[model samples]
Target: MAWVYLIIAGIFEIGWAIALKYTEGFSRPWPTVFFGVSMTLSVWMLALALKTIPVGTGYAIWTGIGAAGTAILGMILFGESHDGWRLFSIALIVIGIVALKISSS
Candidate 1:
């Protein structure tokens, strides 16, 4: 259950991050609202997960998911770099996230 919350939180972290680009510095009304909602949910879910998960492990995994996911979305959605090294870096982050989960268990 806690893991589920953490995963959801991480996903929302990615959602808010991607939505940030669309927010256009908070000038866009709809995207700004979406960003705010996603951010709130992300934090709330993190809090729930933290009730059981260690802070260090939980936080690192959450941010790792967010960072890797946002980077992938940036490349796919916004024409950001898709270089081999960049992809490899993202894969490493994912590997770290998986390792953390396994260690925590």
Candidate 2:
């Protein structure tokens, strides 16, 4: 299903983003390779999802979910700063994604 592809794409998006941080501006070999592979998968899945979903709606949902998920992971795993406004903004992103899903139905 397109939703499954979107979920996998989101997961790969996270992996690639984290790997990119470790890539050291592509100066490192292992992380760079990992990032490349994950990024390839992410974009491929996105394209596949587009086969069944509208581009604007699908892209907004995909990116919104990915950004919110990644931000949460960064805050939890990397001890990144998270103040009230950041939390509120991320919550709004979640709500917006939910609204989009609901409207699509």
Candidate 3:
């Protein structure tokens, strides 16, 4: 289904985002390659999902997944932050994503 592709694409977006951080400004070979590949796949999947889903709603949900996942992973894996406000903001993004999905259906 299109929703499945969208979710997978969003997860790949998180992967590419983290891989980009490891790329060291494209200086590193493997991480850079990973980022490139992941980014391509993510975009490809997003486009595929867009064939069925409304652009505005689908894109918003995709970004919401990527942003929230990236922030949470940054805190857990990269040492970005554990701030309450940051967590709250991520929660809000999640809530918004859910609301959008519910409204779309």
Candidate 4:
């Protein structure tokens, strides 16, 4: 349950991050609203997960997911770099996230 919340929070963290690009410095109303909502949900879910999960472990995993996910989306959606090294770096972050989850369990 707590893991589920944490995963959802991580996803919302990605959502808010991507939406931020569309927000154009908060000048775009719709994207700004989406960013706000997703950010709120992400934080709320993180709070729920933190009720059980250790703060350091949970926060690291959450940010790891966000960072890796947002990077992938940036490449796919915004024509950002898809270099081998960049991909490898994202994979390492994913590996770290998996390791943290396994260690926590």
Which candidate achieves the best lDDT against the true structure? Answer: 4
Error of 2 at 24 (Å): 1.1
lDDT of each: 0.98, 0.87, 0.96, 0.99
Candidate numbers, best lDDT first, in rank order: 4, 1, 3, 2
Backbone clashes in model 3, listed as residue pairs: none
Q: How many Å off is the CA of 67 in candidate 1?
A: 0.3
The true-versus-predicted C-alpha distance at residue 50 of model 1, in Å, is 0.5
Report the lDDT tens digits of candidate 1 across residue range 1-105.
Answer: 999999999999999999999999999999999999999999999999999999999999999989999999999999999999999999999999999999999
Model 1 is weakest, by summed lDDT over 10 consecutive residues, at 23-32
Off by over 4 Å in 3: none
Worst 10-residue lDDT window for candidate 2 reads 96-105
Decide which is better by TM-score, 2 or 3: 3
How well is each residue in 56-85 modelled by candidate 3, as lDDT tens digits?
999999999999999999999989988999
Which 10 consecutive positions of candidate 4 have the poorest summed lDDT? 75-84
**lDDT digits (tens) for residues 77-99 of candidate 2:** 78987999999999999999888
- For candidate 4, the per-residue lDDT at 19 reads 99
Residue 16 in model 1: shift from native, Å?
0.6
Q: Candidate 3 lDDT (Cα, whole model)? A: 0.96
TM-score between model 4 and native: 0.99
**Model 3 residue 78 lDDT score:** 87
- Model 3, backbone clash pairs (residues 3+ apart or across chains), number: 0
Estimate TM-scores for all models. Answer: 0.99, 0.92, 0.98, 0.99
Show model 4 residue runs off by greater than 4 Å.
Answer: none
